[model samples]
Target: MNGLRVAVLSFAHEHAASYISLLHDRTDVELLTADPDFATAPADELRGRGFAARHGAAYVETYEEALAWGPDAVVICAENARHRDLVLAAAEVGAHVLCEKPLATRVEDAEAMVAACDAAGVVLMTAYPVRFSPEFATLRALVESGALGVVLGGTGTNNGKLPAGRSWFTDPELSGGGALADHVVHVADLLDALLGEEAVAVRAVTNRIVHGDDPRVRAETGGLVSITYAGGAEVTVDCSWSVPDGAPTWGGLTLQVVGTGGVVEIDPFGAHVGGVVAGGAEQAWLGLGENLDALMLEHFLGCVRTGSTPGPDGRAGLRSLRVVAAAQESVAAGGAVVRLTPSSAR
Candidate 1:
């Protein structure tokens, strides 16, 4: 059987590197990458033609050339605001897409991306690797099996160091609304999957106090988002870039679920070996668990091969984007509650 030809659209997001490295050696995938937008990216950043060469993947100079190569699938790791265009391009060429998270900076753009893929009859999977975590799957099972009855509310934290390496992360025009936009979608999508319901309202408070001294930090550095779901469950997310630079890892995600029966908490990054290096003073942790990104990629490839619909499809991406949009609006309104209509949720 012939392997699938996969093209990576851009390398703006850090995850693009990992995706390429993981897929490059797969016998079932022929890998190609393009990053025309990063032609002049800082040498310190892992992007442009050099990064692709390091991973032993074929590199192209432009999106047009990549799509023209006739790939079976495309992975979009462009900036938050650029997702719509890349997705539209892939859809036009009948290539399935796995778009990076937050989907888009605006609701209208996300909606348009979803609509275009649907019309083109191509699979549009949202790049939400967290959904593939075994820990989260266990939590969902407990909730569904009556082990945790009637989920009341929960708290989730997706804290990470400020992405200083990528200047675009702090630019609202390119990356959307800072921590709120960068972090909220993961937990929101998890909640949506667990409850199988839409968010009814959102209220949020954001501040620029964390990285405020940096002139380049135009977006909020920290935020707390309260989401009310249609199932009458509430989840509060701490979407903040609060992790200091000295941390052993980039960041971590932790969730605590409360229900009438009991409470359960999970730290996906908790299962790791921590120790000081022989010549270094700082401690480092080596993760000893499954790589969620690899699992997600396998799932995506499986869906493409079988012509099955992906879980957390384009609609799921739009749903999570809606939560982030509402959160941003709430922040703009000084923490006022922003309601979402049922029709809009659909």
Candidate 2:
């Protein structure tokens, strides 16, 4: 009921900047900051850009010390590989956690994170801000209300240009994988929210058609993953980073849902009216709609106050990641259909 005290864990994931913006803009949230290492890529963007000190919040050197301030929750913005330890530490300190998704590079760690949170009685929420996008909300409501009749399958795309500033995104060791790892979770979580079911099987394909010029890139720049939900509904997610630097609006989601009754299409970022200023100059279509990040922060804080279940809980993240892992496995197995096991289910 009172103001929500929050701490941001890391800025390794660029989305932390957006989360910082949302938490900063909120009057009901008292924010704090902690980045374990100041010499890494995250620190360069967060500290060099002065986002860490901009709000005048107390800054700590480690996540352990950040919890000393007694925050009700902490948003873990660390890399995919770092989520487990940060989440376990936060949950150990009796703080709810809101973690950036693709919860872990490995399903085992993800399951462990959820178990730790469950053991500590702290909610572990996976950040799925795309579900918070207002336009996306309406679409989910429509499909759930049976406006689409018998649901068939949906297509989701979250393609983007190379993560120019954040090089770790293309580093398999840091981000898990290229397009398949970085991009798959968003759509998987979307399907989780919209369909209210789990993906029973997955088949994926990954390639390096783009970003071949860079020797530093070890991850594929493009990927297409097909998911088969429990109810027999199917969907394809395009999590490619194939767009050019000059593409409009970084990258946006294009979702097309098909059903026996009719079809629904959504472009969450396209509602913003913008024109091309200079194609090659970088600033393309700018979003003028309501901010999804702000809405997500508000929701997370509200859930903390009410002790409500985090909408997309850690289990939900694990589910999405199971699909991602399956996709990755499928890619490795020559695009074979990967069957997930019950023990893997949360």
Candidate 3:
């Protein structure tokens, strides 16, 4: 296989650092990064962390410069609002794109990105690492195999208290929306993956119960959204940054999928590192496995090289974005039902 040249557009997501590490360790990829404020202190901090230069990677000052390297693909890790422009640019260059979730804040922008990629005949995959998790992947396989029979309903949640450190997540305009937008997609994408369908109707309710007093926080910290898919599957998504600092590990994400034969529960929250005591003492918790960024990167590169389509494509992104828009509309309408159609289901 030929080496796949890859570049990162921004480093604000906090996951940007992880992507750097993943790219550096891969022999099949050449990593590059770019930010307009490349010389800024925070950007310098990222550079100093060995992400920008480790293994001969370059940190360019502009996204166009990064693209000038003639990459086969680019990962859009910039803030939510910057996604559409980057995706369009990459697609125009005939490069496949792996953009972070929420694709874009507006549905029209998301649709345009998809259209651009389709016109270029390049892949446009969303960064939904959860769908690639081993357990979750197995669950999807089981569902596809009909081991669980027909799925009736599912529930997904994304909950956590304030970071106790820095938080760029509270800005609604920047991060898109609050808990509903951030958390809803995971469930939405997972349900879409499991059911092999997209959500067509939704009713949502959100609130600013936490982080409201802070002048710096620009979005609500918590809320819930309910959805019904056109495929006859129902899902409820719960999320908040108000879970309390001392809440238990399991309090964060409790994903449940129910089917005719059995059910699956995925508890992805925890704070333990792996270790064991001599006697009957404490056995340290094993954290989540592998680097999802690298895994996703590998899959994307493989697809690009082999001319295959990856999961959570442009249509999936548009569908998820529509759900987010519907949830917001539902919240604005006092939890009224909103309906939409995904291109795939159309």
Best by TM-score: 1
Clashes of 2: 0
- Computed on alpha carbons, the lDDT of every model, listed in order, comes to 0.91, 0.83, 0.76
Model 2 alpha-carbon drift over 4 Å, by segment: 42-51, 54-57, 278-284, 343-346
lDDT per residue as tens, model 1, 1-346:
6799999998999899889999997999998899998855667777888888888889989999999999999999998989999999999999999999989999999889988998999999998898899999999999999999999999999999998668889989999879999999999988888888899999999999998999988999999999999889999999888889888888989899999999999888789899899688888889879999999999999988887999889999899999999999998899999999874444
Q: Write the per-residue lDDT of candidate 2 for residues 229-343, one digit (tens) a residue.
A: 8888999998888887766667878889999989988888777666556554545465777887777777788778778887888899998888888998999999999987654
Model 2 lDDT, full chain set: 0.83
lDDT of 3 by residue, 1-346 (tens): 5678988887656566677778777877877888663343233344322545653557877888988888888888776877888999999889898888888889899989989998999999988877776768778888889988888888888886664322445667667887777777767887777777777789888877687787867776777788887768888888787766544332456678899889988764443465665574655445556656667777887888987889878778878888888988888899899887656542
> Once superposed on the true structure, which residue ranges of model 1 sit more than 4 Å away at CA?
343-346
Best by lDDT: 1
What is residue 154's positional error in candidate 3, in angstroms? Answer: 1.7
